[model samples]
Target: MTIDPEASPPRPPGRPRSREADEAILGAALDLLIERGMGATSIEQIARRAGVTRATVYRRFPNLTDLLVRAIEWEYQNTQPEALSWPDVPAMIRDWAGQLSVPRSRRLIRRLYGTVDDLPELLRAYDTAHGSHRGRAVRSTLEQARTTGQLPPHTDPETLQLILSGAALQHLAAYPDTTEPKDIEAYFLAVLRQVGFPAASPSPSRRSTQR
Candidate 1:
């Protein structure tokens, strides 16, 4: 039998990629980012921690920024609030408090922000991946609040979002020790009230539990 000269060559059989190695690399990248920040963490460290070859990591994530950003996104998917839309400010605040209560989570957040100037690509990638949808959801929640009189009729959802976001970051800096969910919730509620948020009352369960 004569092989056609124009026919494509047969592909060589190669080893299939390991899910475990992929997970290990991602987890190592996230942990390094949280512990050492971008400046201090290196691909070599990640590879050593992940027990994978540097070539393997490069094959999976050709870009360092992409690797770190993907690792952060993975962490958020696993640890952050799950709801795409919140019904009220209190619910959103509670979820935020719950996630921020974890010291590791707070450290990760700080590291991400710290890398803004050094590794802006990471932030840009993250915004591209998750910020747009979450931002729209937040604005919609604020609009619902305005409609329900939780906010003033003239309240600008966009501005309020910026203020609340700044408040949370400031709170993190000012009261790093305040890791308890109830305490964080109280602090956020106070900030909201000060900003004329007038959020709807939390559920009876939360009220009783807080007390």
Candidate 2:
């Protein structure tokens, strides 16, 4: 017996729902933001670049801002450097600095800062998503340092954490166009020194090791 194509249970309304499409849309949104900045990115552009219909895009994201926030969050969650497990404070700070200096991460951060004034709400969303987690990590690292006596008696982890985070953000904003590896390293080291970590030295013995 010949079977008719229509006889196949009508496959859900249109192209089968695809998780891949959702990821593609999010990825495209992130790439566009980094390349063109938030003001120039639109839902239509995301849909087109993601190879999905506008309706499909809407099915995943209600609006451009929502998509943008999700895209940033997704990228942050997936791209965050693996948590460092250094035995002491200075090493942890150095590891954090190295992670932040990664080229793609630096670009994403610079783009985010560039759009902050125009998209305050989106920036707020981004902060709310990443800030809490980051704060906790900073607190933990600082507390560990305090317990080990790596930090001075007067040092406050919360205040220092805010300073470090703000400084790093500002540094990225200040040098969005310059991708010099040494510049990035120097910026972080400057912040570290400002916060009381000694300037990094070529020879380990030249620096007062903070363990």
In terms of TM-score, the best-performing candidate is 1
Candidate 2 local lDDT, residue 40: 89
> Looking at candidate 1, what is the lDDT of residue 98?
87
Off by over 4 Å in 1: 1-15, 77-82, 199-211
TM-score, candidate number 1: 0.80
Model 2, position 71, has a per-residue lDDT of 86
**Residue pairs clashing, model 2:** none
The CA lDDT at 191 in model 1 is 77
Q: After superposition, how far is residue 42 of candidate 2 from its true place, in Å?
A: 1.0
Q: Which candidate should be chosen as best, given lDDT against the real structure?
A: 1
**What are the RMSDs of all candidates, in order?**
9.3, 7.3
Tens digits of per-residue lDDT, candidate 2, 8-65, equal 4444667666779889999999888888888789998988898776777887688998
lDDT of 1: 0.80
